[model samples]
Target chain A: MAQGGGRVQRAAVIGCGTVGASWAALFLVHGLDVTATDPAEGAEERLRAFVEGARAQLAGFGLTGSGRLRFVPRVPEALDGAEFVQENAPETEALKRALLAEIDRLLPPQVLVASSTSALLRSAIVADCARPERVLVAHPFNPPHLVPLVEIVAGDAATAARAAAFYRGLGRRPVILRREMPGHIANRLASALYREAVNLVAEGVASVADIDAALCHGPGLRWAAMGPHMTYHLGGGAGGIAHYLAHLGPSQERRWASLGNPALTPEVQAAIVAGVAEEAAGLSVAELEARRDRALVGILKARETVAPDPAQDGTAEE
Target chain B: MAQGGGRVQRAAVIGCGTVGASWAALFLVHGLDVTATDPAEGAEERLRAFVEGARAQLAGFGLTGSGRLRFVPRVPEALDGAEFVQENAPETEALKRALLAEIDRLLPPQVLVASSTSALLRSAIVADCARPERVLVAHPFNPPHLVPLVEIVAGDAATAARAAAFYRGLGRRPVILRREMPGHIANRLASALYREAVNLVAEGVASVADIDAALCHGPGLRWAAMGPHMTYHLGGGAGGIAHYLAHLGPSQERRWASLGNPALTPEVQAAIVAGVAEEAAGLSVAELEARRDRALVGILKARETVAPDPAQDGTAEE
Candidate 1:
């Protein structure tokens, strides 16, 4: 929504994990100066290599020469002069509180700090920060350089608009959760689906590969275009959502009745591992990651053209 | 893989509703001789227009000369000599069972009769058919010609292999569920998610738009390539799924505590409608459908080079 003269220029990635590294790379590729940091030993080398791989991906998207990237030794160094901070640190209430306090302490009051924690509440993370109003959650998927979504949940109203705008400046789509809860929106939805998927595997009803296949092959692609409510609306013909619920509701209700209770027992874990291993088949973890990254790069680039900027945020993750 | 001439020649679209019509058009434009039929009155004209739109899409895919189109007025007429059948009749069991029985009475035993039912069990549909051995569920998304994945669920051993091979012949990415369930795999996974989405909307945690924005902008896009299991695997780094479950498992469990039990009460329905309507803004249902179709076409064509075959039992439909 800009005339190309002004938007986000400086960004920071806190925590230097896979998601963090991807965020740093994405920010840099979008022409923002990205300062990435972590306190772990050898974090710099790890982030450097991660950024290198992401740059190759960014280059594939014709974005390698757009901006700058740097690795810092500490959180304060990462936050220096940064307009936006994407925190990807471990999802601990204590660590996040301490980190936000430090970030707010180091940066100007207006700087937006986003927690990349996939599950923690924005309120909890910014509890001890001086300007909690400026801190929010902008959770991005791993390999953020490719995935375009930025789930922005504000700690308080003051930060919501600015946080949303800052992410928009980053060339990322951000959805604001009016209120906070565990898993926010996307991850929570994903939790529900994963729970059932795991349950199905545990019950010997389906294989992990088959379960994934059912989604990516069927509704997953449908969801890539439309969400469940809308899909049911269409399925209803002229009757719309109300009609769909009336007719198909009985069927779904019946199916729901038989749906397994999501008990994550040891037996369930074994089923998941074996099922996933079967699903992985020939692909090693590294191979799967590369494959996922490559496909994700294509998907992100493709969606940049068609993906909506509007908020209708139900992800498998939600 | 087929040896020489790796081309799809013959295909059939049974039950010419929305999904059926889309399938007919897609197959025709893909250069396969599509035998389209439905029991409903005026299905021919509807099928014709649907094929025209799909032809335009096929042209977009540079497949102008890829396939031919044909429409028949009768169920047996469509199934005659067809290599594959995409049945898109009503989802009701009585209707599906009757239709499959009729289809089985006419189609050759070698031909693959794939149902387009989104939720009905493959075995149940093929239960009373004469050549039930060749009848498998080849469920596809709304627009079959565009979405790359085809959920191929073979009820038994013989039908499974045939289903896989047939989808391969059609150039679809097929994933076989080892067994059957109420909604098969995708819908079940999605149901879990949708149930929560409905809950979240009803609970006022986030606006419907924001929930959707979280997906289209974030994890939904990543899922276009990799799945939840793989995503968490990568998130786990060197530790793999084992590490992920052990570490994040507690967090996930905690979040699950807050997940509202799904309730389709009046208040919840009103809340859902209001929230979703806000997300839709001014777009009409037709407009939404058009948008979904266009995007689906682009995604499917772009990934045409990467789709797997459906002939093998394991990878049935699309």
Candidate 2:
């Protein structure tokens, strides 16, 4: 199968934990042969198990590819014939730097190396690499095989464009950041929202269950349809965002001023823990995860029916 | 036709703008007689047109009621036989206070009055009313006929509970606030998220369209399935929120500290306006709205298939 201009037929997946396993599944489902490596005990077994589970979900999206997967005990073995590399080691500065340096030394200059680190800087992680220009951050939301978002941060626009095309070819929505921030784009947006959510819980304004319901039922539903900027554009009415900014910008600033900066004190943490337990009712984490995945599958199917024409928006372009 | 223990068979909707018209449509579809009034020119024509459009969407949800709608020129006429009142006047504190006082004077103490004001405090709005305890704020998300969330803020718990029961009877999710706050729960969370969204745009981290896509494709999808708290709970793995809080609290604080506090300056506003225009991709606001409603319908239908049993979580209870 052709992907990224038919240049990436084989891929190396380093550190086969959850993120790596998910990436491997995605690559395999796109018809790219995957050679995955991890140093942990029983890593291959766990990686295979995860991929098998993910394959079921991928099949729901009609993503069936004929690629084989091989597990290796070392990075060099996995990188032997790889055209692309995805690194998902645990987020330790020294460890990631060393691992990336090793991978950089072994691979050719043209092979794109992407990190799945959510907390560390790409510059710091790529410092020890021989060709840091080829190293980039291609962070995916958890369970990468299911979620379509892949945030790309690169040293140059050309490499970023190449990575975006590759991910887009594999049926992912890749957002390329012009510059790197602490949590990329989505996580930062999510953290901002969650901070206010936590503040509400701490202030005793509402229970955990009610707050969750308010979001999923209200703005959350709209968000699944469009982003904040576009939502406000509609909120602006016929005049659009310009009108909204002219009329409602002051009120937004007022709300922002009153936004809380709550500390995650012990009491607040306890309150949240108890609230989540109550919200979860009697369901275990596994049960909740299953529920979430089921709902996600349903939503993805629903979105497919009404997805915008990507051609008009340059969403599908290289 | 019973609502609020069969005490609210008839509802009076004052100020028939977009919010009021949506409320009127929701009430009518819930099998309540609706008497609506507005002083704006051609208000009746616009309200009827809006309701006609909403009725088609409500029918998709199987909410076909045998209620009747009446348009009255004066508030007293509308309130004459009203068992409940939903006020959607302009969000000026003085105007809302005066309107509530008039509504209070015309109605008996037992009849409940709910305001749809997104801004302004419940106490401030109900201050001039003779029976202030009976008045509360029941703020609905946009297009109240479609979205399910109705945030209720009252001076007392009994009033909030009563309002919640009424809304739940109408097939809406009602989150009752223990105390009133600016922007309520959903809007506050939205603003918190949007602030970062704006910050990203201002900082030139990514394009407006990509930022939006990142959200809807990533966290937004998860949000539709569950709230932020629940998302993080799942993120915590088997150990849950407690484990997450203990381990990830510092990183969260660091991100929060680094979170942008972007000013909606002239330049920032211009950049956002241009970005939204680009994101819309030549689509008009009305077209975007239709797209949003269509996607929302699809999502709601999909959610129905996997909706949790509300009985277990007390989600359907008063």
Candidate 3:
């Protein structure tokens, strides 16, 4: 397969929505020839605009791909000469299944096909593909071009490793799941955190703005530097996680037991909507997105300067 | 109350453990005269060392307070002439209750006493104080001199607002809980996130290191910029959060329902301890901490440059 790659020279993005467009931009910025196709009428314009906008951010990472980008109206045409395929169609199972089947029919078995499905399992989605072994899930976080996490779930270890290497080559931190799970790793963690965040707002424990402030200013800052495990390990002081678990495990259990599971009743949802509006104050969604993206860029730059990822530095065990 | 504050000139730190020392460093760096006391042997020496190490980080934010730090062996001496009190006694309820009562006795009713307890409720701890109304919880995240969050809980809105103003004056983001809850805001969210993180390890979905990488690289970066509510609001596209909830709320609920509540069995604890050891590789806890602090300093600097806290600027509604 394209698994025994030197470097993937050509990539096909088989849907030009935001995810696909971002993938296309990332591929282009990494100097890969990209052929992109989306059925929507204005897909080409939107894709081009996204790439244009993402170029400066990608350039900030010192990535300036010189490869050509071609837009095709059909998936089959885009798959021609493609060594890798990234399918980012709608989230509907039947649609993705049918799309993958068609892509499997058009492409050689050597080409790896990755679906950017955040919620679906690889086993469920790959059922229709004749070469299902080559198809896996490679979920990227939102604004995929910027955020460097790519969670990969594969049918086999080799495929997962190959995907990880490819993404790692592109300056992305690819976490390979030993087993496919809903929401994978990061999203599930995010979902867990968000549930509590929603609960806090639902219970009127704090304003949406204050809760957000608490996160960004508190654990969020630390999480940006390290993960929960590492943070706790550090919190354990000199004796480390062993010491922490020995002493603080009960408190952790108590806190976990007390965590809220609030349903998004209409009233709760309305409160959240209103609270978010108040938090946003005068800033529009676009303005907030822009601000978030800018802040993300600054953080990425800072993290790079302070502590480059050990995985990227070839020190971490796969 | 001393909180009728033009500016708080003197503060008492009622313990010299890590939390107390960090608070002392923060107060001293903000130009507040700090009188600190602790019962532990060599407490003064450790406190001085911590402050000396923290000074460099505080200076990065252009904070170099001219206030004097006095190390007293007794709480009465620490409280003498102190305008505000930050009690960081050990987490034992009985100990904190007695210490707080003593502090309350030593000071006038107007001198606000903020306890730095993470677990004990204000109602429980303040019961011993003659002026229970003036005592409140003002919890800071670890390494408080650096991280900008301070979660406050009080019997009344007036005290909460007063504490918020005081914390804000020190350039800390103080989130006031409308009602006291176990783990308060940030810790609850963190515990929620950590529970999922531990589950992933227990279930063997991914390595602890990879999960950490996924977080720091992805959502952690966005979170450092904005919180979950604002993040989803932006995720809703032009429709904002109302649209997001209307469309994605079901998916959120599904994920939350599927969230795991893993018990920290001995085996599970062993796995996490081992996983953290592997993630840490050869780096000692002190080395990891120093690395984390450096990254934090860099991130804090970057955040300051990109998006100064609106709360500090007096833009957001109290």
Candidate 4:
């Protein structure tokens, strides 16, 4: 194990909101000794409930591991004997800098630290910390315990490398960002697509329902297995992605030029809200969430039935 | 079934290419008597091989039926006594217009005539047809037998409605495009996303491999089940999509403004090709395709296991 490395045996989770709680559950399920700290009143009860829900859900992924968990009210206590710290504090720059600085002062520089801030730059988040090299962003998608993307960005190469390794240890797919960018990589792609999706609705190109169908039943299905680049690579036939770029690149650029930039005016918002209501067909948010979660579980399990990632089958190489 | 449709007991598949053969397999599995026609020599051997492969794949979805299939050398012979025609001719405006026009003259005016053109607009393809109202684009994602989306666009309201019903009857999700637009609904959305993906690679923000992981693990997973609008609806924490737009729409627009527009220069193309090769790890295109297909089947079956759509259980009302 390197200076700030090795398999993460003891970890601290600072902040017990939905993201933090999910991270805590994921860590615990992976058999790590965990101490979670959150300043919110009734944090213990809420965190426990969230972890319990996560434990039940983790069973669907065929993951069952026993890891000790403790809830402490103090940052110092949470930092005690921790090998790794995942800071899931609110997405406020100043608050995170101060909190991370405190942890940096209390813990040894060898302990890897990652924040789950979706939008904040990692450098900015660690600006006040004494050992900024040990800090990075380990942003996860919603339902961190389930979805397997952990984007590692902005730290010393070693720290970023260790963070990526740590996440891989947790049976997650970690992607490295070479440079800092707004919304990172995935969100940038998502934002680009959603801009057009919203524009299509505003321009009356298609109803919100049909637009959703255009994705979930269409490109979205392909995307779940292969991404845009790979899908286009396949679309190129025997000549592969090179042929696609040579032949179809112009058409793609033309389509991009025509993409709309719809402003979300009150009327547009109302139209979207009404369209969603009609498409949802009176299904409540909770009902829809359950449905979505169930489908997610099934898809995840189905992917596993085929080829499992070699990393997923072995121990972490931290 | 409407005037143009009557539960479609007899169907014709013109131009026995990959798309045509797959469409034939789907129709046959659904118990429709299919007559396929192609003029290319040895097309019978190729089409049969494709359909046989499709039949094995369709069995994974628990679909099996005895539907007689006939191969003829002439389109007129194939169209004789056929109630529905799915034309998968070459994607040339002139060729498609001539073929569609010929079919229009020979077939009943009420029979639905759909061209499976991925790029050509339906309006242009049907411009020479006598009954233009009966012709439209019924674009399917690659390997139509597996992917469930059938994008219906650029036809009269009644024709679009009936086509949607016909596809739904075949247990496919048919999304209607309100207006004729280049690339249609799904491809336009896909093109928007892919343009950004290529830009990210060109800009060195991320590698092609990391970008693909960013999606297949992140938003792509959610998208497989729910579209972006609805996913954001859930993100609103019970307030639904309207609340999401009111709160987060500005952030989305900001991200959109920052999206890159990189030209697909030669260097960029080479980088993408090499990146894909590294990611592919020497798996042949056919091998990767089979893997993708297996995963797709698993996901489709898994979704069915959870929530059975009521429409999937009943006949379509055209």
- DockQ, each predicted model: 0.42, 0.70, 0.69, 0.64
List ranges where model 2 is wrong by over 4 Å: A1-4, A304-318, B1-4, B304-318
Candidate 2 chain B: worst-modelled 10 consecutive residues by lDDT: B305-314
How many residue pairs collide in each prediction? Answer: 48, 0, 0, 0
Model 1 misplaced regions, further than 4 Å: A1-9, A60-72, A76-80, A304-308, A311-318, B1-12, B29-32, B62-70, B76-85, B106-112, B303-318
Docking class of 3: medium
Ranked candidates, highest DockQ first: 2, 3, 4, 1
User: Between prediction 1 and prediction 4, which has the larger lDDT?
Assistant: 4
Fnat scores for every prediction:
0.45, 0.79, 0.78, 0.71
List the lowest-lDDT window of 10 residues for candidate 3 chain A.
A309-318
Maximum-DockQ candidate: 2
lDDT of 3 by residue, A163-223 (tens): 7777887778788899999999999999999999999988999988889889999999888
Worst 10 residues of 1 chain B by lDDT: B302-311
lDDT of each: 0.70, 0.88, 0.87, 0.83
Worst 10 residues of 2 chain A by lDDT: A304-313
**Candidate 4 chain B weakest lDDT stretch, 10 residues:** B304-313
Fnat for candidate 2 (0 to 1): 0.79
Question: Which lDDT tens digits does candidate 4 get at residues A1-318?
Answer: 334435677899999988999899998989988999999999999999989988898977777777899999899999999998999998789999999999999998788888888878987888999888888888899888888999988566666767777788787888889987778888888888888888888888888888887788878887888788888877887787888889988877778888887888889889889988877788888788778877888888886321224344333355
> What lDDT tens digits, residue by residue, belong to model 2 across residues B86-145?
999999999999999999998877788999999889989988998999899999998788
Docking class of 2: medium
Superposed on all Cα atoms, the candidates' RMSDs to the truth, in angstroms, are 4.8, 2.4, 2.3, 2.4
lDDT digits (tens) for residues B205-264 of candidate 1: 777666766666556665665566666766677777888888777767777667777768
Q: Write the residue-wise lDDT of candidate 1 on A8-95 in tens digits.
A: 6778888887788877777777778888888899888988888888888778767865667788777778777777778888877898
